[model samples]
Target: MTTVTKNKVTDLFLENAPSFGSFLSLREESKQIVNEKGLPAAKDEEYKFTSVSKKLEQVITDFSTAKPIAVSKDTIKDHLWAGFEGSYLVFNNGIFSKELSAFENSGFGVQMLSESNAIALGSIAKAEKDPFIALNTIYFEDGIQISIPRGKKVDSPILFLFFNQANEGQIISPRILIEVAENAEATFLEHSISLDEAVYFSNSVTEIKVGQNSHVHYSRLQNDGSKAIVVSNFETDIHRDATFTSTVVSLSGDLVRNNLSLRLQDSGCVGNMYGLYLLNGKTHVDNHTNVDHTKPHAESNELYKGILTDQSRGVFNGKIFVRQDAQKTNAFQQNNNILLSEDAIVNTKPQLEIWADDVKCSHGCTTGQLDEEALFYLQARGIDKMQAKGLLLYAFAGEVLEHINDESFRNYIDGLVQERLGSNF
Candidate 1:
């Protein structure tokens, strides 16, 4: 891993890096914030369990000199989700692939961030405390933006496919924005994949705003290559009587970290966040989530589960905040993990801060191995130990998978989980 410091970041990256088109002109305020807050060191409380500072130097040294991956149209068509039933928008190497994309959102509007679009937007994200968001603001110029009209409901879900390929140590930035108008409803399925195995980095950001009385379902499934390093931030804003649901699944990566934040600013708003990870080999995954209840009568629920095999490691941090004005707030959080190997490691922390006397809030975490008694019972039933362990692990992770309302999508994810268990366990 490369060593990260204030001097190295300035001398090696900012000083000699090429410009990022029109985005550079709109990054004054964010640059100031990045300079002031800086990147979180290993000693920082927020990033203690995950060695983010140690891994930072590897991602930025050659990031400014990366060239676009050489890919043909046939390569993109061969690697897509076949049964989505909805039109797809493809981003090839972090740039919108207009020629290879289908153009139907089932009454929703789609806008790619052009120069004019970039000029119209004010601020891209609310992650002021994070330095990766600042890096994205400085280098990203294109992404997807979707808007649903008031009271309009789309039956078919929209697909957002991000294909990142860098064979010679490159970096890519992918961004997305979605807004569901008042009383409208929409669903988005996002897939992140790495096309090449060589060392590379992908920094992605997604912002979602749900209007009053609207609902939005956002799912992110990541299965990158072995040499891929990923950092993504997912932020959500919920209004009165609205609902926001997020499902994050991590199946494969060399190193992956996710920072998710949500704010409930009005009464009757509902926020649900769920995460599931299956790690093997030397893969590492870290998930940090924050939910803020700023208004009365708001509710938030969170659950994250992980299965680590071989020498893999996993970390989870969940925080819930109920303000003084958030009377009658209901917040619950839980984190659980199963370690299959003696060398596998897991760190889980669930925290809650509530100021309102009338609110109900709770948090709990557990990290342990599977039950030997159950394995013995399955062995007596003529089942092999490996198959029996896979079965038990699948059943352990099914609780969060049950929340996926889309049956076909749920079944697809079930297949991935089964394959991982059979091979890793």
Candidate 2:
């Protein structure tokens, strides 16, 4: 047998990263964190259920080189939504593609990170807490910064398309920073997809700042190829009277981990989070969320659901923090899962840490199979077993899907969910 050299993933990435750039100081700081903490292992409490680093090492042999793949306009059109009239930004293999992107109006300001001076780039989603975030800060080639002017309401949603087509095993990191001014309203959609079957790892970070009296709606769809390994971090800060809502849908991937953090900085801020993960084959998906209530009168709600089949596995850990001064805070979190196969498994934990006595905070989780009585009742109505199962599962997922505000995008996601379930609801 030939001798194979093994190296740490952090070392491999550091060796391939550039030593000079405008973000040199920030990158160096992140580099030191990565070198010191490295990727989370099984011993890490936060990542005990998922081994994303080991999965990366098994599929990725060369992290330094990326094979050139041409993506034509027609290729992009194939993936576009049928009736989407909103603005769109495209990223090809972690690099922003201006030629392929389209802006329908000047309602919002967009700038490339390399060309703009973004003071809030590393503010919300600090890299020191997570190794994946640190790696993204170190490896990201280009990113986008979006700003919504004060008092402006964007009529159409903004869609971010992250497409990856790599022949060799490489790492792809995409970064996004969005700032919404006071009294502004905007919606954003993030979709990540892979066109090839190559083994590649994706580490992405997104930070959003919601200004006072503003409302922001954000959604993310992760539908990558079977050989893809993905780790994503999303952090947002909500100011006084601002409202933030986010929905994350994980459909397919070999291994996927999502970390979401929301901070309510002032009174009257509201944060809402919803997530759905449908897994089959040997896929593993982990979702971790944190909602912090710092000021009084703030509110937060979180709900995440998962359906696992075959030998797939799912993990959900959600936490709510009510600080000492966060009186009159109303925070709730829940995670529910349904396992369809005997070999499938799910681990769910919902926690609440309250330092204030006046706060109304509660968290709970449940994991079990589909209700046999409900299935039987559906079968008794002359519905086939498969169709009954599909309808039941669809109903289970509908609660989360209904939160999606855009009708067109909601229908699109509904169709994808039906297709994955192999039946219409």
lDDT of 2 at 147: 97
TM-scores of the models, in the order given? 0.93, 0.96
What TM-score does candidate 1 get on C-alpha atoms?
A: 0.93
Q: How many pairs in model 1 have backbone atoms within 3 A of each other, for residues 3 or more apart or on separate chains, i.e. clashes?
A: 0
Q: List lDDT for all candidates, in order.
A: 0.79, 0.88
> How well is each residue in 100-167 modelled by candidate 2, as lDDT tens digits?
88884758999999889988989899999788898898888879999999999998889999888765
Model 1, position 107, has a per-residue lDDT of 93
Query: Which stretches in model 1 have alpha-carbon errors above 4 Å?
Result: 1-7, 16-25, 59-61, 65-67, 70-73, 115-124
TM-score of 2: 0.96
Q: Model 1, range 185-301, lDDT digits (tens) per residue?
A: 888887877776767778788788899999888877889998788889888889999999888889988889899999998999999999999999999999999999999999999
